[model samples]
Target chain A: MTVRDPFAMTALDAVRAFRARERSAVEITRSALDRVARHDRAVGAFLRVDAEGALAAAATLDARLAAGDAMTDRPLAGAVVAVKDVLATRGLRTTCASRMLEHYVPPYDAWTVARLRDAGAVIVGKTNMDEFAMGSSTENSAFHPTRNPWDLTRTPGGSSGGSAAAVAARFAHAALGTDTGGSVRQPAALTGIVGLKPTYGRVSRYGLVAFASSLDVVSPFAQTVADAALLYESIAGPDAHDATSVDRPVERADLSRGASVLKGLRVGVPREYFGDGLDADVSAGLRRALDQMAAAGAELVELSMPHTSHAVATYYVLAPAEASSNLARFDGVRYGLRADGRDLRSLYGATRDRGFGPEVKRRILLGTFALSAGYFDAFYGRAQKVRTLIARDFTEAFAKVDVLATPTSPTVAFKLGERTADPLAMYLADVCTLPASLVGVPALSLPVGLGASGLPVGLQLIAPAFEEARLLTVAHGVEELLGRLSLPSLD
Target chain B: MAIDVTPARVRATADLARLDLRDDEVGPFAGQLQKILDHIAALEALDVSAVAPTSHVLDLACPLREDAPAPGVLRDEAMAQAPRSEQGAFVVPQFVDE
Candidate 1:
């Protein structure tokens, strides 16, 4: 096997080696599992590691290859991918980073998980996540918090922090993560990787543990756009299991095409995204990134999203309200950890009391109150209206520009426990990310530069719904310009 | 309107959700829940009478499938993790006696 540095190989590179007979699928899978064993102690990226299962799957793929299968038929064959704990994998313990479901083994694989298996990809294991994907940082996870690979003292961003950190630490070639609000993108930014949140309904939600059903999306995190696109292609399609999945055809354009310039593309910079609370270093990095695009022949325009400031407030209300309802299933009756009690009522009470993490409880209470009879009109109802305004702002802007660009997060990864005591400060991390979620748009976060604290910053590019091709095209161009030298070393 | 979530309300809500809470937890949770509610309450100030409530992002009607026998968890495995169970069913205390 070509084991110069297992962590450095992309999914494509590993597949190529397996096809060329230079390495067997078993060798690549073992290398990946070995890397996880070596580094996961410090990174805390995975909650469960299926070393034997992954090896067995790899052996099967190797046997299939020996039977003379065509490479084109199984492009992702033999590639190892990590699944976030929130996405159910049949027979594998899917925790959703909460104690309530810690021992719950799902009966069926989530839509995405089935797709991955169909594509011949070996599942490495389930990575950690915030309980029910509710928090911006993975610290809200009932299990151990994931540490940033670049700097252990810093956060890896969150909700999908484990997925991002896993990919960053090279524990997996690619990882699937859910983005509700900023779950996937912010973590990608913090970890110096690429994360893509496809348009809502573009991917099925069948096996995914729901946080905010309307806003949540399953996406991919990888070192490059091509890798993310490859993973997305495998998982994006309508599913009979999920009514919310869209039946749209995948747009097949040459994503890897080298365009010397972006001359005709109109890149809009929302004035609201560049305003007051943005960190100085983040602003500088964004400006420099825009300048690079301009130099490469793209037209830059300053646009306005009038309802931008209200996005965070609307999201806080709407998301929690949905979360409250979706999480009602874990009542200690059907599955998972149950608290001891003498009576049924006490059983329910004690189970939920001990099962939920602090953040999950707080959100459940907040959401329930927001949707209550007396408060519905004032909180949940009004947030829905504001959501429409936010969506309209994006629609208006897209009319004038092909794509909009902004900083993925206002600041780089903060110190561990920095904003844990101040919920408002933590909510602000999603300020630049929530607008796109509100509108059901496709967005990409690509590492742009390092911040003053030497952490990574991401430049976000958003396109209209189902316009992932255009977004990927622009992101690829910018990524090439930025170069991969900017990637942080976990060592 | 700023609604103050007092300890009494927290306890009541806990009861509604069927979650047990200690005396110490009620006070802190009340304070934290009140702050969160206050943050969410800011939405009430906006005017949204003309805006339509969007429940889901999809434009398609809900697709219905005919009932069919499908592979599901075995009864024993399904109840394996349950704290209390009887013959092929989850066991719970009887709420009333005839």
Candidate 2:
């Protein structure tokens, strides 16, 4: 029950303890970097380490504390946070874990990154991700695949695997990731941590490299719900920089007083998520958590999201369609890698062929074909309508329940290299997490317990769009009932 | 009806994407793309004529900015990123038709 290692402390507690002078920012930042240094060669959580920048920030916080600055406005003062490679971090290389942007340092910070600095969070380093946030596992990273810290043989589900691994491995207090589909939650579920995908446009995407434009969401990874809320608060808000950024005011549940109790809470258990393809460990774990919630005065209502089976198919079409258009800007005329050719068209082809990885190429082609002449209505257009039907399913389900609950991933972290050979198999990894993304609802995966393989199982809670506060509050109630999840050793 | 995923089709799509896919990539990409296409065929059975396509989930119109000059990346910074830069511009391969 006692945590002596300051690195193991959650971001919220660490910030408070550091502010109270119980620990120094420099020490916590140092502990964070030190842990990454020790285990990252095995985990590959961070693509690049910004030790010098992080240390300088930590030193500044130390000086302010020494000068007796209360740092009243900066709630995250002295906290170590990891930025995903996909975000544009000024002066630091924002690779997106693709060769195309391997050395492309952005001229400006992502709005979320700027806000993190404004709130006094040290930018630890850029975490690894699937190239263009396109894959379910970190294997698609043009860089090395990130290993699951829980079990090295397995993957830490991705495209945000590196972010999730960093938090689970105690390398960072919390890490920012983009969830185009299940990048944040799936990885968090597999790695044994907490991840929240804010409602679409909940957080600004000013400097986040575009993936699937409509589906992409900037999200967070933390070891605890309180820490997730704190991180979400630091970054979530309106930004004029991004036109899609919603102007809605942020409303976070007060996690201070153990506020959200399970009493009278109506949780909908989708029957579709519990059917075939549901792994035994995930099924057992979810059932156990629901029973605990029911015992603690929460009501579980069985509901059917009829269009659930079509989520993966619909997302693949719509996401790639958007990605094809969004990624068209990567021609040789811009930043990132370029390969010369005899003419304009040849140059573009050469550069793209040399720069992009396989998954990115596949998605671009799939998207292109979907939106191409004659096939548009059959593929891209049809997917969009099915997307509407899927969203309507949630709208109807929510009328009878507070939040929809399900498993984050169908199973625990599968063996690395297991599904890398099959694109169809990899697409199914996000099946449970895709419906929320397609509908633009706020959803999160809370660490429940270790499954049969001694790996983590996450219970997903999804709320209506712009209902992040309710989502987090209900998740907090579940977290309270489940208690702090004990993590696996790196050994 | 499932569209035939042929090597010719893969090449055609790649050309549209300006991908310049390698010769070896054609067959594999075709097979993989076909598998995905088959899976997505599940959507074809449902009649969605009554449903409106949702391009963006929120249904918010694009917030237009005034048509005025706004500050962006400096010329020097922008030029620095180009692989082939000339007198303050990007240099592209000449495409004078034969």
TM-score of each: 0.96, 0.98
List the pairs of residues colliding in candidate 2: none
Best by lDDT: 2
The candidate that achieves the highest TM-score relative to the unseen native structure = 2
lDDT of every predicted structure (CA atoms): 0.85, 0.90
Model 1, residue A290: distance off in Å is 0.6
Where model 1 places Cα greater than 4 Å from the true spot, the runs are A1-3, A259-261, A485-489, B65-77
In candidate 2, what are the lDDT values of residues A320-386, reduced to their tens digit? 9999999999998868899988889999999999999999999999999999999999998899999
- What are the fnat scores of the candidates, in the order listed? 0.57, 0.86
Q: Is the docking of candidate 1 incorrect, acceptable, medium or high quality?
A: medium
Return the top candidate by DockQ.
Answer: 2
